[model samples]
Target: MRFDKKIIKYIVATAILALSLYLSARQIAFDDLIMQLQGLDYVWVLYSIPVIIASNIIRALRWREIHTPLSTEVKTHNAFSAIMIGHLLNSFTLRFGELARPIILAKKEKLPFAAVISTAVLEGGVDFAFLIILFFISLVFLSEPLFKLLNFDSVFQGSLGIFIIVLVVITALFFIYRYRRQLWQWSKSILPAKFASKLEDSMSAFVQGFVSLRNPLFYFKMTLYTILLWLSYALIMYLVSFAFAFQSAIQLSFIDSIILVVFAGIATAIAFTPGAVGVYHLVVASIMTTLYSITSNEAFAYATIIHIITLLVQSCIGAIYLIYEGISTIKLGEMKK
Candidate 1:
C-alpha cells in the first residue's frame, strides 16, 4: 500500500510538472532564450556563489539551534551534511528530504529518530511563520501590482481573508499547545494502556525538541540567523539580477529584489514538485514580466539559470558531504527503513 501511494504521488507530481513546463515554455522563443543566456555576464553570478553557500550554512546553524533544547549534541558538520542531503533529495522528490534528513541525522548521531524529527518539525513551523510574515510585508509594498497579477477584484477582501485564516490557524495551534496535558490525559483515557505508554514517551521527546523556543536568548539568536539567512537570499537575487541580459531594460533595486525573493520563497516553500522545478520558474518569470517589464524570454532565461545553478550547487555540495560521511546509496535506503 505504501509503495502504491508513493507511485501515485510520483504520477501526480509528474503530471503537474509537465503542465507547468508547458505553460511556462508555451510563449517563450528558444532562440531568444538562447540569446538571453549567451549575453555574457558570468561575473555577477560568480559573486552570488558565496552568498548562496552562506544561506545554507545559516540554515544548518538554525537547525542546530532548534535541536539545542533536545540536549542533542549534533556535530555542526553532520548537521550541514544532512541539510545538503535533504536539498539534494528534494531536487528529485517533493518533501522526501524532510523525512530523509532526520532519519539520516539520527542514525549518524545515535539519537532517537522521533526526537530528531521533532526539531525538523519545529524548523519547518518557524520557516512557515517567517514566510507568512514576509508575504504580508511584500503585499504591503507591492499590493497594487500583486493584486492585478493575481486578478483579485478587491485587495482588502483578499488580504483580510488570508489574515483571518492565518490567525485562526495560529490560535488553534496555541490552544492545542496550552492544553496539551489535558489532551494527553484524554487520549490516555481512551487508548489501551500499552499504546498510551508509548504515546507518552513519544510526546515527551517531541516536546523536548521545542524547549528552545521558550528561551529568550535562543529566540534572539535564531531571529538574527533567520534575518541574515533571508538577507543572503535577497543578496543573491540582487547579484544575479545583474547577470541577465535584461539589466539594461529593467532596473532592479534592493527593494525589488526583496519583493522578488519574497514571492520566490513562497513559491518554493509551497510547491510540491521536485525542487519546485516548473512552479518556481513560472512564478519568477511571471513576476518579472508582469511587474518588472522584463521580456518573457529574458525572464524565463533568468529563472532557468537560477534554478539550474541552485540545483547543481546543492547537489554537488551534498554529494561531497555524502562521500565524506560515508553515506552510500545502500545506507540511504536502509535509513528509510
Candidate 2:
C-alpha cells in the first residue's frame, strides 16, 4: 500500500513538473534564454547563496524556539540539521520533508513525536497567516497595476471573500473547542473506545506543545524571528536581481522583489511539483512579461537561474547533513513511520 502511494505521488509530481515546463517553454525562445543566462553577471547570483544559508539558519533557530516549549532538550544544531535534511527531501519528494523533519528531531532528542508534530503544525499555521498578510500588503501597493495587468480583479475579490469565510469558520471552530467541555464527550461518543482514548491523550500532548504561547516575551520573540526569516528570503531575491543589472529594461527594485516573493510564495504553496519546478517559473515569467513588460525569454532565464541556485544550495547542504548524521534518504522515509 505504501509503495503504491509512493508511486502515485511520483506520477503526480512528474505530471505537474512536465506541464509546468511545457507552459514555461512554449512561450519563450530557449536559445535566447540560454544566451541571456550565459552572459549575465554571476557574482550577484552567487551572493544569494550566503543569504539563503542565513535564512535557513534563522528558520532553524525559529523552529528551536517553537520546540523548546515542548521539550527543553531540543538543541539548535539538531533542529538546524533536521530542517536541512527535510529541505533536501522536500526537493525530491512532494512535502515528505515536513514529516521527516519532526520525526528525525523526535528520534534524536527523545521527544514525543506527536508533540513535535504539533509544533510543526503550529509553525505552518503561523507562516500561512504571515503569507496572507504579505499578500494583502503587496496587493495594496501594486493593486492598480496588478489588477490591470492580470485582469485578476474578479479572482482577487473572490479569493478575499473565501479567505474571510475560511477565517470565520476556523475561528468559530477554535472557540467551540476551547469553551465546550462537552466537545470531548461528543467526540468520544462517535469514535471507537480505543480510538477515543488515544485521541484524548494526543490532544493533551498537542496542547501542551503550545505552552510557549503563554509567555508574552517568547511569543514576541517568535513573531520577530518569523518576520526576520521572511525578510531574509526577500533579501535573497533582491540580491539576485542585481545579476541581471545589465538588462536596463528589467528594473527590478526591492519593492518588485517583494512582490515577486509573494507571487512565488503563493505559486509554490499551490504547486504540486517537487520544489515548485515549472509552476514557479511560469508564475515568475508571467508576472515579468505581463506586468513589468519584460520579454518572456529574459524573465524565464531569470527564473531558471534563481530557482536552480536555490535547489543546488538546499540539496548540497541537505546532503552534507545527511552524511554527518549517518542518515540515508530511505532511513529518512522510515522515520516517517
User: Would you list the C-alpha lDDT of every candidate in the order shown?
Assistant: 0.83, 0.83
Best by TM-score: 1
Model 1 Cα shift for residue 120 (angstroms): 1.6
Off by over 4 Å in 1: 1-4, 142-153
Q: Count the backbone clashes (under 3 Å) in each candidate.
A: 0, 0
Model 1 C-alpha lDDT per residue in residues 281-335, reported as the tens digit of each score: 9889989889877889988988888888778888889888878878876877887
Candidate 2 global CA lDDT score: 0.83
Q: Write the per-residue lDDT of candidate 2 for residues 161-273, one digit (tens) a residue.
A: 96997789799979887966788788899999999999888888777777877888887877898889888888888888788843565667777777888888888888888
Give the least accurate 10-residue stretch of model 1, judged by summed lDDT.
Answer: 142-151
Per-residue lDDT value at 293 in model 1: 76
Alpha carbon deviation, residue 7, candidate 2 (Å): 4.3
